[model samples]
Target chain A: MASRMRIRAKAADGVTEVKALMSHPMETGQRKDAEGNPIPAHYITEVTALHNDKVVLQAYWGAAVSQNPFLHFRFKGGAEGDTVTIKWVDNKGESQSDDTKI
Target chain B: MNHHRRTFLKLGGAAFGAVATAALWPLRAIAAAVRPNAAFEATALDGAYKQLGGTPAESADIDLSTPDIAENGAVVPVSVTSKLPGTEAIYILIEKNPNPLAAGFMIPEGTEPFVSVRVKVAQTCNVIAVVKAGGKLYSAAKETKVTLGGCGG
Candidate 1:
């Protein structure tokens, strides 16, 4: 699947701030369609970030997470021009990964 | 029995895969040690807390930011920052949702003890931020009034 994350990473004072917006429906199983059929649960189950090939952050999500989730975090040890990779996997096994330079 | 062994092997393989994908990060250990699927499905705060394996101690060091009133329950911005040292993990929970545990984050060393994300609110309820630091659980909560419900709620 195509990467659906919009990521931005910036470095300052030996720290890197990473922000990302992920596009997803995040449908809860209880939600019904216009015809009133229940929608199956479909939401990002996990999200991870790697900085310079080292794991930095990981998040576990549930159906309660909002659609098109936004995430922001910061870490030390990344320098200018370093690479930060973000990846996510949904309950349906769909996945997306993308990288940005700090 | 053959069936038991097969199930164990499948679980072992899944645990290995989760670790390898993260390069054996510390967070992998925490995630592997605890399987919170039941917690996520729990309908009550106490039930979710029980599934998490520990009771959180309310603290003032956690900075939980949420709006006083959410115009739409479909999307509510939630952020948490822990002033406590040795912070390792953060969790967002909504008191009234069918599944109270919205998300969990593992914070590695040298990473700021801060996380921000959006959550779906089914109704007016208390939003809680639980932080695990130094092997102890601490939490802060704030009430958010939802003017309009969302998530088919």
Candidate 2:
């Protein structure tokens, strides 16, 4: 579905820092269009991060989160060439996964 | 000009009333449930802690990183890192939001206990980070000054 996610991973001082930027509307269902029509709630509900196929971080989010959410974290046991994967699922059952090399 | 001032005052009064009522609304029906729904709906921090399975939280092992002054409330960078071993989960809470449970993260084994993200802040309020590790809860809080209002304000 052409999910737009920018991911970066870097290794330093025995810690691998992973940062990701996911693109989504993140509508809270409380906003109204210019014509005053209510926008339905559409937001990323779950986000999971993996380090070389092992789960590192799993997050549950709500609509109160800001648009185009940014996620960052650090984990041990990753080298400069290791791979980190990030996946997100929205409230509407849509999902996306992306990977980056440290 | 007097009529305009009176109209503005009336609107202002009505807005204040709405805010006061919304803040005081008791949504405790979910408290009896076994799930974590009440934690999100609870307006007060202590009440939310109770809803989330209260265990005395210590602040020594937790670190909450945030700018002292947030120029934009729509996206304020917040991060939580715990030095405690066997950390299982971390939760972010904003004290004054309509629904304060901003985000919760489950930290799996072999992973470091850390999480960072941008969250919306309704106003100048304390941002609390709760960590569950080794079957116990720990927390740390920091106040962020927001110059701009977010969260439907």
Candidate 3:
């Protein structure tokens, strides 16, 4: 899907806060337009978060999820100015990654 | 600057500030807006989050409340309260949302077990709470429904 995403992250005192939002139709296969045409699947399948290249968080999702997904999570053992990066990819093979400092 | 231009600039800047703010505020507000379907969806179960260890959730007693039926799909009130000691973090998730993740809070050690926010939910689903106490993950969840639909919601 031709959509954009925004991510924000902060790490400190051995803990981190990471939030993300992705743009997509998130069309559930069950959805049908006015013409009653089935909307094919379009939604995020994987999300990953890393701290200095060390895997920290990840999840798998399905179309049952809502549109423009938003997530908030935390990390441990981090300090100020530490780099927190997040990456997300949908079933359609669209993906993006960005990072922020604590 | 002429008086009228100055007035216009002042007025325009003020107006611009309001309009610009309104435009930008909704971006986060819309993303964080909560809906009915935001309840009952499981969170952090996929081990998608960084954990203290192999144990992703610690399961302390907590209360995550949303109206079983929400009137507005745009901004639903969600609160999480934990009875666990040394509560450091409380993360909120809208289970059925496009992302199934809503707001993540980094609670200071002394923070009360409760945190509330407006989240966006696209359908009917559960909301989950993942609490961290003394460096471990614990959680609970419930279901809510969204009746009104659309961006106006």
Candidate 4:
């Protein structure tokens, strides 16, 4: 998807705090072209974050969502230096993934 | 001859018309530029709005501190403090962004509503701070300006 994504995480106070930013047009079909044509809806529909293979959080998004989504979430019991993986898939089946360790 | 005076008047009128058009150039350009669905964007907020379930926000009891104007859109400083009891969550939203949701925090009980951070705003937008406490939402907003183009993903 040629996505430009950045992830930052911190495991403190027994919580794995995660901040994620990803790139996607997230076009809602209701939008129009230069000629006033309806631009089809295209957006990342699902995103999941994992801490050492255990799913920490997952969400389902919709066209109402905006482009270049930015998300922040945290989980209990994650430790420093643990690997955190995040993945997202768009409505068109396009996908992107990345990982960062705290 | 009177015709010469009339001819001069016609030239003067043409020059005056040109100057008038030049003075109004910016307004004309803005009028032609897209005005964005300001109303729709104003009402449609971002983030998992339902996850932090609460009553629709009312503009009372939340002390939202921010600049009257944000000189930079890429990283505007934002802070939220509240008088609401047992404040549990705070969210930042940009009303003019394609998606109004900028950031959401699930502040654990006892976690303060005093949160500070930088948020990216693509254009001139309203920054909404929603504080959830005691199962209700109290909110406030400030208008921030993004002078440079930071809207790019």
TM-scores for chain A, candidates in order?
0.94, 0.95, 0.85, 0.94
Output the lDDT of residue B48, model 2. 75
As for TM-score, the candidate ahead, 1 or 4, is 1
If the candidates were sorted by their TM-score against the true structure, best first, what order would they fall in? 1, 2, 3, 4
Candidate of highest DockQ: 1
Interface RMSD of each: 1.4, 2.9, 9.0, 9.5
Best by TM-score: 1
- Per-residue alpha-carbon lDDT of model 1 for B1-153, expressed as tens digits? 999999999999999998788885766565633436887888899988887768899999999999999999989999999999999889999999988999998898988999999999999999999999988889999999999985745
In terms of lDDT, model 1 sits at: 0.89
- What is the CA-based DockQ of model 2? 0.38
Give candidate 3 regions above 4 Å deviation: A1-4, B1-68, B72-141, B149-153
Task: Report the candidate with higher DockQ, 3 versus 4.
Answer: 4
Which rank order by lDDT, best down to worst? 1, 2, 4, 3
* DockQ of every candidate structure: 0.63, 0.38, 0.03, 0.04
Candidate 1: regions farther than 4 A off = A1-3, B1-35
For all predicted structures, in order, the TM-scores are: 0.86, 0.78, 0.50, 0.49
Query: Across residues A13-93, which tens digit of lDDT does each residue of candidate 2 receive?
Result: 888888899998887776788788898989888888898888788788877678899998888879988899999888899
What value does the lDDT take at residue B37 in candidate 2? 52
How much is the lDDT of residue A60 in candidate 1?
87
Please provide, for model 4 over B44-111, each residue's C-alpha lDDT reduced to its tens digit, 9 standing for 90 to 100: 56333443344346767887766666666655667677778876656666776666655554455323
For candidate 2, lDDT tens digit of each residue in B106-136?
A: 8877667888899988899999899988877
